[model samples]
Target: MKSILITTTALVGFAATAGAQEVNVVSWGGAYEKSQVEAYNKPFTEETGITVNMIAADNPATPLKAQVEANNVTGDVFDIEVSDAIRMCDEGALVEIDPADLPAAPDGTAAADDFIDGALQDCAVANIFWGTVIAYDTTKFEGQAPSTAADFFDLETYPGKRGLPKNPKRTLYLALIADGASPDEIYDLLGSDEGVQRAFDKLDTIKSDVVWWEAGAQPPQLLADGEVTMATGYNGRFFDAMVGEGKPFEIIWDGQYMDMDMFVIPKDAPNPEAAMEYLKFATDTQRLADQAKYIAYGPARQSSASLVGMYQDGKTEMAPHMPTNPDHLETAVMDDPEFWADHDAELSERFNAWLASS
Candidate 1:
């Protein structure tokens, strides 16, 4: 009887070990992914005994679309732009998520109420509000530094290659901003033929001096290499390069393009249960706020705002560096995911044609 009992206990232990899971998450690489690993993945595994596998992509949505089309869904969760989330959800490639299923705030506020507007969706939940803003090398300008959007395009004074992303989503908005358009009317203007042409016309001014960047990590590297003096890049990446690595860089918050990154599970994910569990764990108020310690992006949860504090260095405060800060938002262009979902392909074509033209 003693031997039989021991055998049974050993079998149960083996079964428990076999039940352990590893969730695969696709995300943008660099310091942003590091934040998730520290604040979400590590603690989640310690508490739940589930491992997390992070996969990097230029944009997670690209791999997600390929996996869905190929019918071999490997990644469990994808960290994608809100526009990509909206577009993918519309195509029925993503699973529907209920806000009620998410954990409520510590104060008993509902998740739906706690999250900022546009943070929750039927198929996605936002994690951070980041920005595409201007970053210039402080040592580049001796007397007067570039302070605004117009300064980015003034080649005569700045006199260095400008790093602009190779996408219309990021470039077009800046062109409009530099051309003296109001941030509130960016989307509306882009919707018209004249406005689209005007944006391209502004681009024509500095096309000869533009050094195009395709990845989030490239802008900083371009600036560091002296390939570009002023560049448009993710605020978090620039923050990491500046504060974390002690790069001689400074961010010009003028005309930032703000957008949220949402976490979504595909319908046929390899580990649906684990994916959902990780998603719920990672987007809670505390986790969202904790991420602020590593990156300057704002937490998506309203309750998380008060919880945010000093940076990971334990010295620098994270608030003023955040893209959502009031001073930074004065000229910020808020991303319209719905508008991008509808117009991305069309505008991308035009942008490509202009880039290819003389």
Candidate 2:
């Protein structure tokens, strides 16, 4: 009887081990996402003996919703743009995060505290931050660079072909700012008919010189190929082109628009606990810093700033992407994700119509 009982216990243990599940993660495709999986997820899998299945989705929302509605919300943890994160939370598609269940919150004095206040929130934590800065071909601009949106629109002073995102939020914001509206006044101004018309009118003046970029990667290519002398683009893409390819491109940090990308756990995720553990590990300072070296998106953890020096040699400087750089961060405006989340559909429709008609 004792031998039989021991055999039963051993069989049950083997069964439990065999039943251990894999967590599926959905994230954008980029160097940062690849580094995150390598540094954090792979280690977590090794330590816990749980498998990780990563899926790349250019826009996380479509796949996320399809999985949830199909009752297969197996993509346990995913990263999405801040605007999409907010929209998902509103749609009841994301799970509420319980901080206590996560790895002990980083000690308050640790690098985590350096995250910009209000950047971290209940539904999501900022994973990486990037900016849409003015990227200009150094060969063309030389010493003179466009400093602000007004400069971008000023064809008389800085005449050249320019590229801009086809997305309505950026286009509208830049329009208002170029038309002499403050960043704070953008949403309010767009709320009225006159303000919207004013923005459209301002855009009309520069329409002939503008080339629309449909993808994030296109702007960097446009500048490198000399298709456009100046373009609006994310800092990381421009940094990679300049540093990796030795392209003569430079980013103007003045009046850049800062946007946060966040990590979230989907509702009905099969392995919420494991996913939370992965998030905690991914946000650790050392790993985040290593990621920053390869990918120009700034780390959300404050401690990662100290690690910047490790990447900088006499020949190379990583300062262009560091979030804590006072001169860069001071003038950078945090995009209002909530407004974009609410108005994107209508705004996108109208913007597309205008683009097509123009």
Which ranges in model 2 have alpha carbons more than 4 Å from their true place? 1-21, 49-51, 104-115, 312-315
TM-score (C-alpha, index-matched) for candidate 2: 0.83
Best of the candidates, TM-score: 1
The backbone clash count of each candidate, in order, is 0, 1
| lDDT tens digits by residue: candidate 2, 65-170 | 7887898886888877888778878788787654433322233353224565645666777767788788888777656667777888888777789899988777
Q: List the residue pairs that clash in candidate 1.
A: none
Residue 73, model 2, lDDT: 81
Score every model by TM-score. Answer: 0.95, 0.83
lDDT of 1 by residue, 1-358 (tens): 3433443354345336647888999999999999999999987777667789999999899999999999999999999999999989999999999998887777778899999999999899999999999999988888988999999989988889999999999999899999999999999899999999889989999999999988799998998899989999999999999999999999999999999999999998988888887898899878899999999999999989999999999999999999989989899999999999999999999899888988
lDDT score of residue 17 within candidate 1: 62
Which regions of candidate 1 are displaced past 4 Å?
1-18
At residue 150, give the lDDT of candidate 1: 93
